[model samples]
Target: MKLEAIPRLSLGYLPTPIEKMERLSAELGITLSVKRDDFTGFGGGGNKVRKLEYLMADAVAQGVKVLITTGGHQSNHARMTAAAARKYGMKPILVLRGNRPDLYQGNLLLDHLFGAEIDFLDPDAYFTEINPRMAHHAAEAEARDEKAYIIPLGGASALGAMGYVNAVKELSEQYAAAGTPAPRYLVAPVGSGGTLAGLHIGCSLYWPETEVVGIAVTGSAVPFSERIAVMANAGAELLDLEKRWTADDIRIENDYIGPGYSIPSDAGNAAIKLAGNREGMLLDPVYTGKAFAGIIGCVEKGSIEKGSSVLFIHCGGSPALFPYAGLLTSDLAG
Candidate 1:
């Protein structure tokens, strides 16, 4: 598909390790492996680096000197984008949801460390007001003799999703080299939908037998599936591919998102602790924890076959855990 012809920035440590989780595998009675995108190693490492590698390349190609994006206060994507902007010599402006916290910790702290300009708005205002104002914000930067680029929430644009398409290819090569059978199931956390979209398209093309499942940390399955399908189709078009995706192709479980987005759920906390104790691996409550919980749920409900091989994409957000210490500690206690 001439994917190499696409322009991309050299960012992130590629071919991140795919290690088998022996303890977790035995516990679940299935072969469990982890795709450690958390080790991506740019701006404190995360899956967002994969997306930004392409998104920022597009920004730089457009001669943009400023990058603007929006997300929650502790958004891993926003944090990574800020770090990436600094690396490429572009100013980053983050329009974050919610008022400034009494104490800045976790990713919000890293945002300041990266020197990103921060503006806070109420959650409702951010979605209803600030989102539509992004172009205006960019225009204001232009008036100041600066070229600005607006990256959507979670870097979910078609261009950004190309990163995961490349990731799937990398993963296929890894499986081949290790002489391991292709996993029957691939799971990842879905927030803004781009990662799942790219994974679905890539899996369909590269490893057709594998079913990609997304654990929604926010909304319900049906609407999120539709959103992911749209992203996949758009990404296919961006790559000049003829692949078309529909909601039917997306398999997402919305039951894992307990309470609401960003609030620590009991099940998510347990998953985080389980991964920590069993595999010596860390998972953040907001994303990976809930996703892993969903994986456990799938096994319990017999959705995943007893002896099946599954690959869990660890999309990384360990830093966010620091800010939720009180909640996690209380939940884990007793």
Candidate 2:
């Protein structure tokens, strides 16, 4: 796909390790392993760092002095964006979609530690309020003779999706080094769809045999698969690849998204505990926890065949765990 032609900064630990989970594999009746993007090792380390590598490079090239983004209160993207902006010597402004908490915790605490200018809006205003508010901040920066770059929700732009496309390339090399066939299925959480879209394009190019399964963590009025297909095609266009994706090409498990976004569900919390206790892997409630639960759901429902090889992308959100400590401890306590 000529991914090397793109401008990207070295912002993460390249080629994160893939580790087999022997204990969890047996329990699930499948050969299971995880790509540890959690250890990306920058801005508190997460999947977003992969996208920011390309995004920050563009921002620097454009002489952007202020960076603005929006997300929920405990968004890992917001925390990492603030960190990336600080690392690159730019001001970060977070216009989050919620009221300010009485006490900062989890990713919110880290965002403050990074010295980001933070604003809180009503949760109901998410779709309507985020862009206009960010534009206002951009105008203010312009008045001060500073250039501002507005990164979209979760860095889901076509250019940023290149990060995960590059990641799948890394995955192909890893499997080749081990002299093993690629897994039958690749699984990951789907938030803004950039990561999934990238994986779709990447797998199409490198690991065509493997299917990518997206676990949606949020309920959206617009179908996420359609959105993801559009994103994947856009990314494919950037890579100059002839392949295009349709909504039917995307396989999404939507049942695991319980209650609402950011609300912990019984199944999700149990999955978090199972991973931590069995595999010593820590996953948060918002993203990884729900996605992990989806893996179990798929296996139980026979959607993923027994004894098949499955690889999960651990996209990282353990920082958000702190904010949910009270509920988790109460629910998971023996």
Candidate 3:
């Protein structure tokens, strides 16, 4: 099955730009470039839009009327999913893990703006209650003659990962057009593993020599490498490809996740300032900041050799920045 044969609901601005991060490269003493997945327009733009394209396509094909998904309160995935559902004329229900704050800022605000029905849950109750509740909601919708399609957190299914496989193909073309060799390493943030998994499979097939590195933003609690391998294999099966991946195929750095998922780390805060000041790029403290911090750490520790070409996948979550204004502003000021 060719990737083109798969159903996709063109939700993003494809072929997002690849540009040289000259200042950042100079700072790190490497040939560094950035793939702006952040530029993927729709619901404030982020890497999640890619996955939603494939996921929502399947929903539409199955005659889905309500799209159900789970995420954290500030989940960029949830915000994008809600926007995509609205664009496709389907209702979106977001089962978010976190308290309903008196002030809805960042992605939560966007979720409301998109008119998604949101159910906020306590963090401890997320695993125990969210899935069952989502199922119940779907059942109720079905009873009302409305079909519901449940998308797991981060849209990390095999079908969703296909979006990044297609992205890898796009990156190959972009590299060729720019007359640059395929990068020695491709770095991205790993939240629920689908994007990294798709990149691993895509790199294995398209750019065999490039090592794909995933920065585990969720810490070691989630076996990201194992999950990536599973999703990659599943995505391969969906594409009717014979290749299979194992945990050994994935390279993930888990030490950079400061306190835990969604908690701002010193390195991440510094990274956010560095990128904004040096490259005029915005990286949310949750995902891209930590991932970029990993890249910087690698460069500083000589894990990435000097002069090596590197491509950092900027999976955007800039809107989430608004919620952390106090921490970021204070840190930046001090």
Candidate 4:
């Protein structure tokens, strides 16, 4: 499936390195490494960089003068896509979900800094609801004779998923070059499901030996499983891959989502603190923290084999820390 066949501008720092987390591994009694997708060379570094590259490339190719996207108030995708849009000289319109923050912070701050137009929502509108607003805003921009483009939330489309598919190709080469063993399990926080689906498809096609495990940072496995399958199938088709994976091929664990999306969890806070103090790794409360807690819990419950090499994909969100300062305070241990 020649991943580069699709249009993508150079945005993210390609092939974000995989670093071994020796300190955290010793503390947890497992061989642990982190795929630093957070440093993927996007806006402040994140998994979103890869997706935005393809999305904006399409926008530019179509002569888009305005780039419109939707997400939560603190969406990494929106922030990065806005940056990409600016780089291409196109204005960005962010249809933000929910109430605007009392204080602009994190991704929201960056969005404003990038001069992306802010369209606030009902503090509870789903992406399905947020999307049409984006289209309406696009129409409004078009009425002014400006070309508009809509890049959906999380950039979960088939083309964007190809970024991770390309990532696996990069990983496979890195493993071969470094003479490292393939991980027994690949773990990541699943939100929009595109990243995990890409991992599932990429690993199945290339690194067949590794098992892909997605810890739901939000949402339930029942729905995410379907989304993952659809994405993987679509991504596979995008790549012209012959083999398609079924539901049996995907493994998702939603046991660690605490109080829903973007909400804080005690376990998540603890996990973030543990990683920070023990491994000198910073993880945000929403995504990576909860996902890490899930990994720790799974290991404790024997859901993950004791001696297997477990690789955790730090999908990034460290900037969300501003709003949840209290939870992170006094939580770290030496």
Candidate 5:
């Protein structure tokens, strides 16, 4: 069960650059760098592309003709999934939360441009309705004699998490090349927990001693840290790795969410502006912005000690910025 033995498509640019954020590091009194997964370079470049490489390989193996997945209206995952499906010559069907808006912008616009079939459900219907809707799409595909593959929410399944486990391995090599020690902490945004799950396992096996912290962008009744532990173990099983994770092993910061999911938080917007103005990097409101805000919050609270080396995973969602133009412009002006 070697990771290399697993089937994966070459969908994203590998080993996205790791750049030191000197200004932010000095400002925060900690050494800070970013793993630029935002530059993954496929389907508009995001962390989802890594997960899709494995998922798409599975779909192709199963002779899938239609790919189905669920996400919010501005879901970066949905946008990337659409692109991956098209690249593999499979049809993509997205079941998104919320009613259709009069204007299609941001990732929604890209989803449409990718020529995906989309269905919008009421916001309250998301949890209860998404699975059934995806199943319905599958049944319809069956009626047409075309196979549909349903990807889980955020592509959080064990198979897809392999992408980040491999990423940790890549990071290890990069650290060695740059002659830097393993980072004191690795931070990332957690929406569905798949990426964090993979990183936990990856850090355990490839870069020991580096703690991983996930910043939750969306609140969930089901404790995502516990859920992500189970997922990491499942991925470990897939890779035949000896490391086993538990809820205690996973650390998630949930305070920075500000409001509900998809709605930009004041702190998140400020963090977005800070990153853009300081590092010339764009961070979306949904994920990376809140995650960076968490980093700032943690530093202010002394949770992350001064002079510690921290690396943030810039999981791409900058296109999501387009949809929040009004809010962001107001922040910029004020």
Candidate 6:
């Protein structure tokens, strides 16, 4: 597929490192590797860095002077976008979805530190509410003759999905260099559905022999799968290929979405501790930790065959961890 149509923004750390986890692999009876997209070469890294690069690039291309996006109160995506907007000298306005609007913690603190303006919504509001709300604020900027751009939560547009497309492209080279076969399965948390869809479609075209697993961090499997199908097809179309995807091609796990989005689960907390204690790698309770929980459970249940190589995309959410300090600290005390 031609990659040039996607816009620019100079927001991400490119060609992130991929490494095998020998110790964790042995314990789980499977070879596990991780693509560290977390270190996206910017202020506090995450997968959003990749999406923002293309999304923001498009904004500037369209002559946008103000950029607006939204997420939960402690959303890593929002925090990173604020940092990115500042770095490129664009105005950032964020609409947050959370229960506590007054207390600035976790990514919210970073949002303020980055000087992103705030708008809050009730925690129980529908997931679709934030976008229109952000757009409304952007309208005010446009009235003043300042160009405004609206970026969706998690930046899950077809153009933004190209970031993960390039990610799989990067993986092909990494595996070839190490003389290891491309991982049989790639797992990542599904929040806004862009990253999972991008990697899945990218693998289909670039490798076509791998399975991409989605561990739903938010939303249900039914809705998540439907959304993924739409984006994957869009990505394939961009590549000028007509590929029909069947149900068998996508795997979504609802076994670990415990409680709700951004809340801590016991399994997720355990995975976080195990990863830190064993590999010295940190996972936030919101995304990566919950994703790892799914991995641990699936492997233990013999769902993923033993000896098969698995790769987890470590999309960073470290900024959300501090807001969850009560859980981690309590676990530590216990």
lDDT of each: 0.90, 0.94, 0.91, 0.83, 0.94, 0.83
What lDDT is obtained when candidate 5 is compared to the true structure? 0.94
TM-scores, each model vs. reference: 0.97, 0.98, 0.97, 0.95, 0.98, 0.95
Candidate 6 has what TM-score?
0.95
Report the C-alpha lDDT of model 4 over 1-334, residue by residue, as the tens digit. Answer: 5786788888988888999988878777789999998888667888888777777778888899998888777688888888888899999898877786678987899889999998898865554577678879989989999999887668888877877887788888998899997899999888888888889878977789899999987874358888888889998888788768777767888788989888878888889888988878889887899999999998989988777799898888877887777557753545
Model 1 ranges with Cα > 4 A deviation: 220-222, 331-334
Off by over 4 Å in 5: 331-334
RMSD of each: 1.5, 1.1, 1.2, 2.2, 1.0, 1.8
Of the pair 3 and 4, which is ahead by lDDT? Answer: 3
Better of 1 and 4 by lDDT: 1
Error of 3 at 69 (Å): 0.4
Give stretches of model 2 more than 4 Å off. 331-334
Q: Cα miss at 288, model 4 (Å)?
A: 0.9
- What 10-residue stretch in candidate 1 is worst by lDDT? 124-133
Can you write out model 2's per-residue Cα lDDT over 232-265, one digit (the tens) per residue? Answer: 9999899899999889989999999999899888
lDDT of 3 by residue, 141-172 (tens): 99999999999989999999988998999999
* Backbone clash numbers for all candidates listed: 0, 0, 0, 3, 0, 3
Clashing pairs in 6: 8-57, 9-57, 13-40
